[model samples]
Target: MSTNSWDPWNYRSGSDFGTGHDLAGLSVQATDGHIGKVDEATYETGGSYLVVDTGPWIFGKKVLLPAAVVRSVDVEKKDIYVDLTKDQIKSSPKFEEGGTWSDTTHRDEVGTYYGQYDKGL
Candidate 1:
């Protein structure tokens, strides 16, 4: 995805998938099937994301999903939908626990990985 994909609306206060509700613990669904649940989420204007806990799906690993990938949010159902498939999420860049996402290098690594799918790179 382009950097503009990270511009915030995907998870901003007044955007399509964004709302004034806590997203923690909400189930996350991929295009193909269920992936996990939101372990953490950020609402920063330019840097938003969902940190999903794959709970046994990936040996209890967590993956960071950029807000841009979020396709929709179902507040009533407590679910977040993304445009990617399980395999795609599974093979994306690994998220090291306790690592800060504010680090540009790490963000770039992740952005690049996801970008490839968007750009068909």
Candidate 2:
């Protein structure tokens, strides 16, 4: 498990949780909080900046976690978590069957909805 010093709900504005790291192959947790191993991550290509595969979390529901929405990462524990609640993730944008990432679509749907989350820092 990631052993980084992560404070509870540290994702609010002007908090240290916003400063995360590369998201490739990081562990993913489900809404019920079950640990789902990350299978893939799309970045810097095809407009997919932060596309990650939770395997089944996005089955018709592509829970796109914007760069800004991220809360923090525990490199030691090999985990990268977000700030959103279980319901939020479940209600986020939904992708196609066996689909990939798209920045334009995300910007229009997820980014526009989340706002300031697509601005890569």
Candidate 3:
């Protein structure tokens, strides 16, 4: 499903940006949310992302996501959904949080990880 059809598109809106918010319950699965995390941040251009906190293994890391990887959102419970799997998410190369994604090299990995899944959405 497109972000527009999601129940709570507030995050999809621009009213709130660069502010801390809660997305803990959103069903974030890759490959249609079978394995992603919560809907973390929606970019300024209407693109949403999943913050894959690397947990204790790789420390707390995060990543960016576009609608291409997103499948839907649960508005009734204020949740976000996706169409991915855990192995796929876990297998992807990890990154450090916050200050990481700024390099061209770092940005390139996004596509590398996403691979054909990007589909240029």
Q: Which candidate number would show the highest TM-score if scored against the true structure?
A: 1
| Cα displacement (Å) at residue 12, model 2 | 11
**Candidates sorted by TM-score, descending order?**
1, 2, 3
Task: Estimate, for each residue in 2-95, the C-alpha lDDT of model 3 and write its tens digit.
Answer: 3233322123332222335555545454453334354355443433445554344334445555434544555555555554565566666556
How high a TM-score does candidate 3 get? Answer: 0.53
Weakest 10 consecutive residues of candidate 2 by summed lDDT: 1-10
Ranking by lDDT: 1, 2, 3
Pairs that collide, model 2: 1-77, 2-77
lDDT of 1 at 93: 84
For all candidates in order, the CA lDDT equals 0.76, 0.49, 0.46
What is the alpha-carbon lDDT for the whole of candidate 2?
A: 0.49
What are the per-residue Cα lDDT tens digits for candidate 1 across 50-107? 8899999999988888777777788888888887899999998876667886667677
* Candidate closer to the true structure by lDDT (higher is better), 1 or 3: 1
Write down the TM-score of every candidate: 0.82, 0.55, 0.53
Superposition error at 30 for model 3 (Å): 3.6
lDDT of 2 by residue, 1-121 (tens): 1233222211334423333355577775532463344444443322333455555554533356555555556677777665555665666677655555553554467655555223322
Where is model 1 more than 4 Å wrong at Cα? 1-15, 119-121
